[model samples]
Target: MFVQTSPGQSGSAHVVVLGNEKGGSGKSTVAMHVAVALLQAGQRVATIDLDCRQQSFTRYINNRSAWARRTGLHLELPVHRCTEPGETMQILDNESSELGQFLNAVSAVERAFDFIVIDTPGSDTYLMRLAHAMADTLVTPINDSFLDFDVLGTVDPMTYSVTGESHYAKMLRDARRKRRQLDGASTDWIVVRNRISALESRNKQLVAEGLNELSLRLGFRSIDGFAEREVYREFYPRGLTALDDLDEALGTGPGAEHVTAQEEVTSLLRQLKLPIDERGRRRAANRAEWFNQVNKPLDVHDILGAPQTGFQAGDRPGPRS
Candidate 1:
């Protein structure tokens, strides 16, 4: 039995872990977007990159900070931390060291932030399992092809039906079970079909069917993720997300593709159903109210504070001499 020594159950932050055993599944991209989206929504969000070697998540955040500095745009950034890989020769010693680092990082921000977005490496590791066990919401982004789906389950060649659970799926089951025993909390696992093609095809239908079947058995929700979009690739260099103000970031009007991409991202966030603070909900409500009143005539009391002195509603102040 893998005992959790650290105070993993005491934190208040909802930990969101992005886990996919296979590479090129868009885990880092999804993690980045989730963190930024939460931050934009008036939530205190922090990010942890457990992939010490690849560090794609870390680099993406660094790129965002650098772009913000160069362009002088106020880009929302998370309190980010990257765990250092162990250097010792002994496997157990290295595991202990790495575990300590991971726990320390979580403990530091778990109470302070509203959400902690963790990007795990492609391959399974001790740290990866640890992160999964601690996740409040686990997001697994798999490419649309069966090659990517193999990580979750094997499909029958004759009928293209899901046959059995895969290694990654089995690992998740164990982690979730352990988590339940430790804290009596269930991890909300979501499988996302990422980089999906725009056109419908026979293969696409088969994959969806397979996902639906597997999700029923595993108790996971499957959702359509970001479509294959060139705009996503363009956003990488500048550390931008579909949720960001594209017009200001790109210095031009956003196109139809950008709009669609933004819609996809927004839809995904809604499907995740992550918890939002009361303040966040109020802020969103206020924002919608403001937009609803954008075209309405402003009242003098609302605009000029009850007509202060000579100021009236819609009054334009004279330029200073």
Candidate 2:
């Protein structure tokens, strides 16, 4: 409902793409959370789900819409769309169909919204590559496990040092090269470690070290993202994220995990350095105060009964010319 027409020079929305080669890496979760956070922060945001086969982000938005209608909150929601290619047998035709549809989607919403959060499929497809090139910010969420680390870099088992770039990392390099050549814009890529264990492990340390070295080498920022908490999944049915009003929706103030979820998101947003309005800033302050007043030691059982949120790891940035 708050969608506005605010096309800058190029008449395009600042595209934020959630990308990862491996499934279950939390791309859809991050996209939804960031989009919702921006909406709450008074930004005219839109969303596009290019994961045509799965449509994970699209489904999540639909859930949010249905929940809002049921509750009569009139919560601000972004205009969202899902784009998939035509069922053309020929490779050329399929590619063309996808390119045309993606371009049409961008044209329809770019000038009308401030941000376009795109959730890409796990595989390397034409649409995925195209979206990557258009991105102003590309957020890649990976788990703490080395299996997930395989998607980014090959870490030496002995020294725990990065041996070489992995396949997905190479793909990103190509995307960045193409992006720079086309628009003279550097895609601000940030790698976030998602679903980290509650307790530290030696493997987690090694993965962090690998990511640190890779961040230096590949020109991306890395940081700690969301924790492995059941509360995240509990919010699914309501289509509510940590950014939403918990007391009204859930019949109670945020619990400890909920509070932590809020902090994780707030910190993540600040780290992204996205453009935020004055009202957004004010709401952020109020949210902090409200959470502080309700912040208390929570039992695990109670925390489980409550909820919600995802990505944006406000970490120390390292990219510079």
Candidate 3:
């Protein structure tokens, strides 16, 4: 059972789990950013990638390992683990086996790390549910579209009314109830709207209004997340996060795009209100300054040693190389 921290108390690592049931919602990307942000803050961070099939989060870390080794850069890498569920003749056996594996994974890092960031697959699974129930902070990243909004709540097309709670919302409520019953730990659910369009449109406004209304009923805080940027994707192959010391590692100063990306990460991390080194400080007075402390401009595209074939920048997506 997880214990909640109180005045003059210490306990397990805070688990921030990123999840959503729909694909292309950028769950893995958000998980990577959050993990890296915590790491850059001089905190001990561990990560778990439950998406065994894609393994995107694990792959990102692997890429990071390669980059750090090649450049001899002192980059902060999380103690990472990936779980592979085994097949069994009986369904109950499979569930039990997977649960044991998940618990073992948690036990391995719970005492060692300050924070554990988990990336769940874009579908409802046994492991996903287990991870969700364990989340101290449940971050649900969604695109700024009604299609994406439907995963949490159903909306009326004619009146733009949120008619009822979706399955995912109900699932979270049940998880919260179970958590309270188990050990009185509460999960903070934050709905982050990512990949927002630069151009303001009626659809965006409608989505915002619908989310606001849903927030009232669902009890989740909403925040603006990363805008659709090619910069986020370009660094994937090299395992470079906006929070990295790209200026020093790449032998060039940071560029405008790099600053923008790091600023977004800093702002997001500040919003998360994560626990760091301070004793009972809760949060830094000006955490945003961490990124701004070093601001320089070199062409991000030009510095990327990997093939820049997939993207050309300016918030556009190209065919995966």
Candidate 4:
């Protein structure tokens, strides 16, 4: 556990919300590991479980707590379960006052955490929309399948050989509109194609091309994201492979799994550009001191109030000439 910082100066309150209407898309799993990865890089991270129905992220955190007790890893991160208003057992509306309360609490926390990762429910509810509204970076994880592609964008080349629209494009437009009216914050939308295969397939190529084309046209960026692998699923059981022993960091072949778990985490950090550096000969703490500094978003106050000077005949106050 790390020390918390005072409010208004949260050392790491950057919020990254993971959202996708489709379930079983590794939303919770990705959220859990991403938070842990940040923690491994020595960041004081916190989580918000917007999926009030299942509270999957909360469950994962509980499992982690149990593991900590048994292994003495002492891993702990604050997981806030949102309480829906009206005392009814229904999905909370993100647009409701209750959702605002959650965001308010996030902002009002006196102690500063390094990162805030939100795990949204697996549906297109008002809460999901609210998560999108609050996200600085919205990560959409989808499996590498045609069904998932449809969620990201349109595929009817024949219907509109001219004007092609996609689900992802519409989502981006909606998010942009909300930002203008409410948050006034820019979003970095990343479409993650999860559960990809190692082998090269024509179908895979088509999906990749579609994603690339859509990203180029719609102003979204796509990374390798996560590939299909057992390690991710295994996390549900052991609460993710520990950072002390990672042999499959390189590969899972005969000698490919020689890398340590720490190395695997470092690899992930490098991939996400989260600022984790390799250790030197000495096993000095490889924790990053400027983790938050690297990914800091422009302060709206600074941007809006920045002074821009245009020289004019009497632009500056001076004695009458």
Candidate 3 per-residue C-alpha lDDT over 192-301 given as tens digits, one digit per residue, 9 for 90 to 100: 99999889999999999999999999889998889888888987898888888887677888888788877887787777666565531222223223324534221222
Q: 1 or 3: which has the higher lDDT?
A: 1
Which ten contiguous residues of candidate 3 have the minimum total lDDT?
A: 297-306
Candidate 1 vs candidate 2, TM-score winner: 1
How do the residues 190-221 of candidate 4 rate in per-residue lDDT, one tens digit apiece? 77777778799977887888888778767666
Candidate 2 matches the true fold with a TM-score of 0.82
Candidates in order have lDDT scores of: 0.81, 0.75, 0.76, 0.58
Query: Candidate 1 on 1-321: residue-level lDDT in tens?
Result: 011122234348889999999988999889998988877665667789999889989999999878877877657777778888888889898888888888888877777667899999999899999999999999999999999999999988999988999999999999999999998999999999998988989989999999999999898999999888999888888899888887777798889999999899988988888886655434434543663666443222222111123113244322111
- In terms of lDDT, the best-performing candidate is 1
Largest TM-score belongs to which candidate? 1
Clash totals for all candidate models: 0, 1, 2, 12
User: Rank by lDDT, descending?
Assistant: 1, 3, 2, 4
Which of candidates 1 and 2 is the stronger one according to lDDT? 1
